[model samples]
Target: MTKRFMTTGLSRRSVLAAALGGIAVPALATRPATAALAVGTAESYVPIAVGAGGGPAGSDRVHVLKVGPDTAHTVLVLVPGMFGAANDFRLLARDLVAQVPGVQVWAFDRREESLADRTGFTTTDPAAYYLDGHYRSLDPATSAFAGHWGLARTLCDLRAVVLAAAGGGRRRVVLGGHSWGATTAMAYAAWDFDGSPGYDQLSALVLMDGGVRGAFAGNGEPVEDSPEQVRERLAAIDGGAVFDLSLSAVGLGSRAESTQIWYQLAGWYAHRDPDGPSVLQPRMPDALRPPVPVTNAALLGVLVDSGFGWPNDISVHSGHLAVSGDVRGWVDTGITPISRVATAYAGGPEPAVWEWYWPARLSVDLDVADAYTDTDLTRSLGLRLFHSGGLDVPLFVFQTSYAQGTIESAAREVVASSRIPYAAYETDNGMNHLDPLFAAPERNTLTTSLPSFITGLR
Candidate 1:
């Protein structure tokens, strides 16, 4: 393995060339030579300042990648799932733009928990950091557990970014998300913050593989981890627990597959931050240290163990890693944990895995637990989509074959409750959670189904 060094402000052309195994990509006449780009594509980052509402004041800089020209009348803002970051959607966004002319696709960088940090985890390894930082950023003082971290504030952040992307409300916006992002999109649709529904801000909602029901129990109860479980997980973050790396192999297929995934994502992160010193070392193959920074202790724990009772949604099959016979059974039998063999950087002197402590327990977890235990149903706090109000605007749900049952039920519930037109497209494609966004085979489905869905909104 040869190490490739990036100079200060490496251009998109150079980044793409190196990312594609040194493929020579010609520079475009329209854009600058040193722009950060996706592999084989020329998507560049546009910074959107989301002020105030987006946790910890002073305008959090949320970078959005724009694909295609902004001449399109409507903008589709897609948020990524658990570990899914903006760069993950680059290839898909480029493909969509090429396939669906006149419609621009914008993918948002995940919002980080506003904590003072110098690890560059947010920029280098967002998938692992955002999930952890979110839980760590929760505080009882500001009511973030129920308010800021909830869908309402999320909508605020989305609105801020949408407005910035649309160049001050010039274009109509349609929102879409995959997995957890899908659920976020649905929440934005049903949210009623200022006496009016947030749905008014968007033209339509495109949910891929997830939605409101993802956080709810079958009996309408909030799905969450118990306080004891949350505590244990938090402790695990401090003490560090050995996770089954085989679980990662399930979703990513193999170590090489996982490396590619990390490579693409890390490359995007690195490209975006050309001015800062490189967070990754020279050709670090220690799977954990593959140019991508390791997640903090809290984030690693939350990602590996808890959160909505379905931790590591990005990894493992059927969303059940603990009890599932295939994966967990192997873990119980002392099968070599995936973390051990999947990457050589598992445990060593000064290991990068879970190096920092997140201190407080996640507010989002407490909020969900409170909603579950509270006797007064009205007082319960959770995602807006699962709440009472049904969307009045056009709602489109794309339920993949292996979509979570909670999400499926939530979509059905919204359909039953919605007085307005609600449509659900159930496809037989055997896609695990993340396939709809990353899998090239499904590009046809996305290009055809999504564009038509958005156009139908007109």
Candidate 2:
């Protein structure tokens, strides 16, 4: 899916009117009252500096936010989704700290620095010049992962935060993240700490609705060539010129023109009501079609084995090769194991759905059209890595009815086929793709489910 930024032209009022037409706003306010949790009298909330990290290649100085009390036993590190800042978790963090006293909450300011400053490129074109530059620079050795700000380097930073907060005391430190941040925490768990000092520090990990997939792995069925390849093919079609002649053909040149077109489309979808109660609600604006043609040509290029490429034949070691197999088999077998354990605490599915039609709004000013590409690549990578034994750790797969059908089905398939032991929970509430993290009151559905799984970890 192509990511576009929502422009001011697509105001909420105008979008709502167009999308909803005669429908009246539901009198039943969607917002639910905050759930009350028992704050133990023995624990106290303490004020502490919560550290934040810049996006890739960011600075060393953590953007510290004050949260919680020092006497709490659990420290939670919150990571945000693409284009999200530390404050996005404020409502959820406030509630979490209140329940688990002495909980030190920290979130990173990924956007504090310009994308250029962090990724080393500058342009305002929404065609993803930044990602093109980034992947081109990926080298196993001498990459940022080895540097102070690399992924492993960030793990060190996290360890420091936990130790300082503990102050010679042993406390439960949980690494939690939303979207990309959640993937980062998972990557940290997968990091090869053979040479890194102080590797065994993390007590637990929480993936708030994020997991490894896509480009993180190499084994999945072959996808259509990467987006960079698609751009190249398009360029070739235009007589070897690097510029996108398609834009010229469409008569969209200035940022304003693109913004206007994007806003109208995004606004409509963002405000549109679903035709019925189902897993797949229309999240995209009516104006936009799937960016790429959903044709045989396109499917051939992108459709591959969904299990991130874990071999279907289970002769290989239990790590990477074990998860590989028929996508349906994996999910089918895997779900049974988790269902056994989750049945005790599993609640009915709370299905909620959100369509951030203009996901690229924040990055559009910087001409970063590939804002969502990273996620796509990440999902691809995750499929391959997890299947190849890169992810052998205990995993708790949470499925909600609100997920896009394709994604939800894929999750179900993988869980059913897996041989390893894990837990699965199908929520009772209406939780959608974005609602798991973006919605405030419903966030507990995620936190509570996670702690229940982790607290049982050996």
Candidate 3:
């Protein structure tokens, strides 16, 4: 297997070669020398138990994809967004570890990832399994317990991972998140752990294109849910809303088509047949599917590219899917590479990162908890938040170009309200919500800036 690098204490020729080669010249020029170590790829996959959790097997453990060495002095612990998994951070983690040597990046997978239908991965005909609906998925009712895996549990679970990384405070830990994962980071900062606060465990916070909404962190859109609405929302799982929508888009589902299958189909096909005619495009809506017959790579780019006008803020500028010639091609926007996106979205083996069992209860909990603020209704609903004011960790917020800017605005308000110090803030108008995570290493803000950010804090 190809070895992955992370910051460790060992000295290696490749590390020096990589640095001398100026792979990340801009970042390495300023980063600490000790932060440049790396370990083998085999040591990265880690899973920690959640004790006796209420959810299904998915909630039994939290998967962590570690880059660098455990002996590193600094750690970057990342949380995945909605329906995201540990593998989602692979490219970003690899990039970050390469630039800054001594920092270990612990990218996490939600308990929900355990529910993904990995069976499809064993098949060579992925399209038959994922696209042609030749598969069987777990019964929704069997996953009912997942509805109880709310924010409180998520935070508590994250706390366990942080404590492990901290090793009794020997390592300085930084928490980062993308999309709803950003919300998770902020919530972790504001979370109350027994008497100690969650921020006490973190040196800094990193947010990418996400913010907490509702009465607490909403930039302008405050949640106006009445107590009754909150109650109804709390009962969502009971009403049979247990999983997030899968396939091309939300609201379209057949029993055989799980989100895992869709992701694997798109990602795998794009990787294997990037220049071939799209297989999934014909099934997608007119707005999302390429107007003309396009290549698989182009098809994947359109799913998140701004050119397609994917209204849900999932849009990014990875360049147009079709570059030239008669058919579509990948036009790199000098941001994210389509190959990297394919790797992230594609699922192959047992530990591949793709979340299929997203608990509707967590979404409910985030909304009802209302930005980590404790209220009478929230408390009555069994949430343990209401501690946003206690968060005082340094903040580093990154907002993509095409977003509404609400995430940054909301983070700013939180920084001000909680008196959190602003370590850094930037807006890359060149990127989209997902671009921040998948940007090319040489030009990525995550790789170029985060190492120094974490090291400086230490």
Which candidate gets the maximum TM-score versus the true structure? 3
Question: Tens digit of lDDT per residue, candidate 2, span 107-162?
Answer: 54332211212121122321243223331322223222222222333444545554
Report, for every candidate in turn, its global Cα lDDT versus the true structure: 0.44, 0.33, 0.65
Clash count per candidate: 8, 73, 14
Taking the tens digit of each residue's C-alpha lDDT, what string does model 3 give over 321-437? 433456666666546667778877775454564566666667666666545577786677566665678777787777765345666776767777786766577776655556666
Number of the predicted model whose lDDT against the real structure is largest: 3
Query: For model 1, which pairs clash?
Result: 11-34, 12-35, 213-406, 244-338, 245-337, 245-338, 245-339, 246-338
Error (Å) of candidate 2 at residue 217 is 14
Cα lDDT tens digits, model 1, 79-193, are 7654345654655576566656567888875444223232333343554553233324323344232223334445667877766656767888888887557656665665555
What lDDT score is found at residue 255 in candidate 1?
23
Where is model 1 more than 4 Å wrong at Cα? Answer: 1-42, 53-59, 113-150, 165-169, 214-222, 225-390, 404-406, 441-444
RMSD in angstroms between candidate 3 and the native structure over all alpha carbons? 10.3
lDDT, residue 426, candidate 3: 75
For candidate 1, the TM-score is: 0.54
